[model samples]
Target: MADVKVAVKILSELKSFVMQVASQEVVLDCFRRSNRDFTRNRKLPFDRLVLLIAKLCKKTLSIELEQFFKELGLENGCSVSAFTQQRIKLKASFFHWWNQVLWQSYYHYSGESTKRWKGLRVIAVDGSNISLLNTPALTKHFGGQSNSHGNFTQAKTFYYYDVLNELVLYPRIEPYRYGEVQMAYEGISQLSADMLVIYDRYFCSYKMFALHLWAEQPIPFIIRGNENQRMVKEFITSGKRSEIVQLAPTCPAIASLKKSGFIITPKTLLEVRLIRVELEKTVEVLVTNLTEANGYSDDQFKELYFLRWGVETNISVQKNIMQLESFSGLTVESVEQDFYATVFMANLHSVLIKDAQSTVNQLSKHKKYPMKVNRNKSFGKLKTSLVSLFIEHQPEQILLILHGHFIRDTLPVRKNRTFARIRKNKPGRSKHRTYSNYKPAC
Candidate 1:
């Protein structure tokens, strides 16, 4: 009951903030046109509600189908069957825009602002592939390649999210055959010059680097050590241990990165920094331009490269744990739409959990209470609360539930484990054919 009340409250809060940003008519029209929902005379929009439901269902359906329901307490109705059978499609752009909207809402509700690092928000770029339902339309479009399932092409997505801002980002998807580097290169157009783009070796391109340099913000790129033989020169020399120096060349890769310099267009140059670090098999000469003379020392450049970890973890949560692959779409377009929506939901939840924790921490100091907010509980509590309230249609009762309810650090459990997840679910024998009504997005 407490959980149900809280779910409703959070749903109400999401709805209220959504309305304040977009008109009800405009929002509904976008959904109707986008074909994300199945609505007939449905006055109020439940796009966020359904997305939250879908996320919960996807996150749990592979785990404990029964307990997933018990957690949400929707055994009698809104079962996994209902969620699947409904087959509501949200606009891919709706999720993209919602990503923007939620960031704004977080700013409004949480009353915390993210300051730009070095007068700019440093964002990073990377890509990962997720499995998708291989319906005829999907197979024809996203064509699965190979894995344990044998040649089901994964949906390759290019992502750009910021680590410092605590902001999650929406990924743009492309066909796997196109390659992640190609996908990442195309995604560079969406990035602004003001943003610092930290990337891996693959993204260091002559043409694309020049484009950011041309952009107003003078894009700064932090790419990894080059494997290309042409990029290698002698930075250090020893048997099996030779430090290679990358002299600044006429490469367009860091054009935007050197905007602070007097020369607007950096002559393609190789910058080398001497450092010792161990890789798996062997530790060889590493070369980076980050030096004591430049703003960054040998250590800071390595630290910047390490920022790459944030994107890796984000992709893991979205793919392995969040079950983002088990989305409710048969077509690649629909899958893309759901993919972004899931991202928005995750980011929104991140903000909520952060805020809840901050609130508890503040109160804890005053009350001398040891209570702190647990991430799982904070996320679970908000999500579970939204499911019940929206389904029950009692938006007004939200505040009462949150009143005086402290976000607890400890999640509820029965000696199972800390931050327990249900074991991997094995599918029962069922017809492999997709629903006949399924149609591809045009």
Candidate 2:
């Protein structure tokens, strides 16, 4: 993780940033706020938490956690006492706080939720299957998927949608071939009132739907149209070949309606709006309890329902782009520890990216405090860019850093990015231009 750490120039700024973010007072208060003492047997100081995070950043990579704890005995030329071993395990509680804090921060930045057709907040639910274990021992802890080669290995998680913010919440994680849907069912009991939950076709079942109604939750639902399901068809195209049609409910449970009411089940009549769209040479059918007169167009409802893609993209970033599957750790505890840590890091970076951009945007608008252009020079795989920037003359500076090489660039409040155009006639032109600048978001 140290390889991913901030450089000295950026570190100073990052320290100030972290202080604001994970300040000691905030950390302690948050820990105490949880109203639980993690280490009741022995007490330990806060520096241990700092060391754990620093080590995660790979600042002191070679030493094992305990060895490092022992090494910390000599930190600042003073010996830390014997009781710090319990500190290591207890410190993880603080990370839980950090996670919650960051989630709240990201939540604010994400956006606010909006209601679907009849003012029910819409939520899209889905899952991502992850390979948590391949080793034999790990398989005992986190089971695997089944296959011809071996029983396939993975953890599938059901994620509840907070679409406006593009964040997934209430994840129900379990092994493949069993338990995911069950866990999701148990977790769904916590859903808020008046929410419209859209489900993948696979989750459609009479038993689950029955549980929802029994709870008296009063939350409407939308799911894909299963071909085998029976329903009363309302408004069919008079002679149109397409099998799709818009409808209001005429179910047995909705007898009072005789035909006009809002009901999710066949018993209670529901006024519904259905849409079938052709995509990729395939017909896709959707069922909704919302009607056309509800002030939300079918097009708008469908567009909002499509927000599930964001969660899939998030999983892609975590497992594919972030190289999580490359993890070589074997223990289940360590793997989960690493997973939570990575989640925290990803959340932190997301917050930082937005924060940095917001800061630059606000300051850049002011005339007296123009943001500077920041040039990011990567050391490159073999440190070639660093060599050119450090050893070569000014002519090679642009050549070395150009062509897809990017470090985490930070733009100052005021700066320029004009490169020379063939040895300019004037010295000012040859040098950097104070007015012209690079991309601020770089």
Candidate 3:
């Protein structure tokens, strides 16, 4: 089918890039901690190590290794100790670079099919906490929080997620103490004019607005503002649906901007549009540089702002479905490796299932509710075929096989799903269980 060809072409592009990365000694050397690393051949070579990490290792190390080798049709495999040592020699930045470049490849190959909103990519910016192992090395590198019960090791992460495309274009992991706004500000340079970014109330800041508006290309953005914000509160008091207002930088924002090499005074003003959207019971204000009333009207603001939820859902998928915190190794390097690799795997899974999703949409048009590919089940199928899709010669056949599996397993698309949030007084670490002897063979 035509869908299978598109899947094959994308997989082949990724395979070629992976091969190019593996074969180039100059590129491989950059990923190595030392020039001596991966210089000689070993059971777990540089190329195999890269692919193995993308496998989403979630079981006992010994069992995962055995299955990985068996999938490659190899009888002999390296020990868990060997994998630990090999991974440490390679930097985690490799996976980060691989993820970014692979996303670029998807966009390049997807062409006109790449989703967009009003001639711009709908990007959502959000931050989340990732629980890290309680090892001294991890705790020392990435700080955690201490409460009445005990100390919990974790990391703060900021993600630039393309909501419409269902891809994480950029991901940043920092120490738990780092601020998300500052992390987001650091990502401003990577923004392009063709992106319209949406943010939640936590990211609402004068400095953030100034950076986006003052950028060379003037990146368009919409940020939800809380009722507590002075600017938002004033807008609500006016009882206007939408208004364009000037925002002056506060002393703290000016100081923060100065540290980032952007000199701004309190007098510096940013012209932003504020829109008020009424919820079922409460009202929320949105701040954005998109002041073109004709193009982006007040009514459209609600749905535009709601798009920010995509990043939150993506984070949930990463943590719950992908088992992101279920780290294979406790060292800082391994943690970083697993984190970025998980992002890559998530994107890969998203790209691979697009064809099946489209087919489901067409077939279910006459049904009561539209249907979608069951992502959890699709992920399992993709994981089993990941090695072959990358290493096997007949990727088209493998893709067709996956397409069949994907179309057969689907779930109905339920809309407007809501749940009440339960607030916990004391924060607790996410509990993930992995048995020592019991591991799934499939």
lDDT of each: 0.54, 0.45, 0.86
Ranking by lDDT: 3, 1, 2
Please give each candidate's TM-score: 0.64, 0.54, 0.94
In candidate 3, what are the lDDT values of residues 118-142, reduced to their tens digit? Answer: 8899999999998886889999999
Question: Which scores higher on lDDT, 2 or 3?
Answer: 3
Compared to the true structure, candidate 1 yields what TM-score?
0.64
Candidate 1 vs candidate 2: which has greater TM-score? 1
Clash pairs, model 3 backbone: none
lDDT for model 3 comes to: 0.86
lDDT string, candidate 1, 158-195, tens digits: 77878665566546777777687656655666777656
- Let me know the TM-score candidate 3 reaches against the reference structure: 0.94
Candidate closest to the true structure, highest TM-score: 3
| Angstrom error at residue 347, model 3 | 0.3
Worst 10 residues of 3 by lDDT: 433-442
